[model samples]
Target: MRMTEAELAQYKRDGYIVFRGLFSPSEIAILRNETARLSAIEADTVIRERTGGVRSIFRVHEADGATRSAAFGALVRTPRVLEPTRQALGTGEVYVYHTKINTKPAIEGTVWMWHQDYGSWQRDGCPRPDMGTFALMLTDSSEMNGALYVVPGSHKRGRVEPYYDESTSYKFWAVPKRDVIEVLKQSPAPVPIVGPAGTCVLFHCNLLHASGHNLSAEDRWHIYISFNACANAPKFTEKSRPDWVVSRNTKPLPIGPDVLNSGTEAELVRATSPN
Candidate 1:
């Protein structure tokens, strides 16, 4: 469904909007099962946390030289996701950038440093900051389980300086701690995004956001589907990451209806597997 004017206004003012229960329980179950199956496999792209625990499984949609599941493709193209994207971008054309499922194990979950996703996109030569992510909850998220946190209206600051941290062995594209503190001084305190499975958050690419470590007894899982305005596709011919990491195809996604059914887990496993 298209976002209401009030929702659009809030996104303009706050850089994010939360939609509670956007997906049904059964729909969430389908995604959760798929995530579990994909994450168990060992792949170079499936990164681990700093402590060497499973971090996330990227590109769940595109697998085995084809789109993995009809349900996933439908979810990506659903008006529930695409309408808001088009409205927020002020453009009708949108293209898939990538998608990933972040799995944070209880007790051993690691923290994600505060960062704007656009910083990395800029490095990839995306001409404008017209990208955003729709983060859908696959498992319940609570403060005790490392829920995502965002600084209200931080996207207004646009892209900030980023540097590499050798200790983390990952490129740290987030702003400095002092800058974050300064922004916090002017903005409201970080808001923890906590909700049950089926909740979703749509945030601007340049929004300053992060999540703490999960310490609760249950695992926390969420999928991030990034979309960019077709007009803002990357300008560079060469890419630094794999196709799954950053899609080479810029085709606009076609909207479809929900495909959820009362299928057994085993049935879903076969349906979602490569043809």
Candidate 2:
């Protein structure tokens, strides 16, 4: 689906724009099933919370063989996601920097500290902030279930200084609390990105955002596909993370049809394979 002129303008101003029910219920159901299967696998890519719950699954776009989910492999190529991402980055040629599924299990889920994604990516050697993420909700997200909170227009500040934070269950480069407070004073109040299953939010990489702990009985699950301009591929750095986390593959992805409707697992893999 193509983005409207208004949607593009909103993204430029707000640093994010939400598309309600962007994916249909059937598609989201497929993703939810795939998420459960991936979370149960014991692998290095499956990062766990301090409580041993699955925190996130990285490089989901690379799943193949018996582990592959045709639905998810197709998601990476789906124009509904890729087209707008191309528009946001102002480049028709783009590659997947990485893809991840973040899961906050009921009651036991942990908090993600306030930070700009670019804060971590910059250290990975990305030269510019010309990147965006398409975060699709696999389950309904609400204030009680740890919905993401984003400071509108915060991306205009560009990359804010970040401190390495280990205070949370998951370690990440976080914006200092003092800096966050100062930013809040100048920008609008942090808005909770609340929405139903299948809703999607495309956000700027430099946007300041965070999420609280899940206080309700329901789980919170969201899959993120981060895209960068092919010309903006990162340079190797001493601090560069693993390929799964920081991909070295800068190949521009070829858009695929809605494979979810017609392809088998093996066909889908071949159709979208980075190789």
Candidate 3:
């Protein structure tokens, strides 16, 4: 579950690293099914894009009865996930800031502007940029399917000014287009993180990245597990977004294994829904 020396070096240099098939096929299948079921449900957490496709389903890991599901909980807490997260952040302990399914819907998903995740975190009053995201692909991500495009080593640039745009199809505070162009001129060639369903991309919070539209006939579903050092938790009490979006819980995750198989199939099915 821990990263090798070479892998750590690459991550330090590139600002990200992809672990292919880090999760087994059986585990991936369960996640895919669970995501589909959550997306179909009528919930306040499920957001719709301007194109009328599902935008994201937030905080499934912290959702009511859903949190009782062993599989969903383990996806974030298991050593395979948690340990590397702690290592990358160089923190002794960490907590799930939030976890959600970000969907690039088949045929109509829109572009995510070039941005650093830490920009938003900074606005949330997190004093440090010592956080990162682990994205688990739930479906094959190809260049044509809106795979993530990252500027290698861009994390070293630190936080950049976000172009505040709320009029777009997907509202986000992004790095301005002009800044992106300049960064591209100096940075290494942008990398398209293409991989299979079980692939996981562990990326630095300050990494500048974006994804284009999905013209292909397949959805790009990625589960983002964002973690923050327990010592570096946000300081603001006044929040702009829902608690689910910005987790209120600062409790460190407990280590466990095989949480998915710990319960019967019937139990998992019943626990997926909050109601």
**Best TM-score among the predictions, by candidate number:** 2
Task: Please write out the lDDT profile of model 3 over residues 241-261, one tens digit for every residue.
Answer: 667778888877766555454
Write the candidate numbers in order of decreasing TM-score.
Answer: 2, 3, 1
Please identify model 2 stretches exceeding 4 Å from their true place: 63-68, 237-239, 261-263
Supply the TM-score for candidate 2.
0.95
Q: Which stretches of candidate 1 lie over 4 Å from their true place?
A: 50-52, 63-70, 166-172, 261-275
TM-score of each: 0.90, 0.95, 0.92
Q: Tens-digit lDDT track for model 1 on 19-130? A: 9989898889877777777667777557777777678776666535432544565567667888998888888888889887788988888788888898778877788999
Best by lDDT, which number?
A: 2
At residue 116, candidate 2 shows an lDDT of 97
Candidate 1 structure, TM-score to reference: 0.90
The whole-model lDDT of each prediction reads 0.80, 0.87, 0.82
Task: Give the alpha carbon lDDT tens digit for every residue of 1-275 in model 2.
Answer: 77899999999999999999888787787788889998888877888888899888888886543334667778989999999999999999999898889899999888899999999888888899989999999999999999999999999999998999997666889999999999999999999999899889999999999999999998899999999898888887776798887877788887887765544667776667655
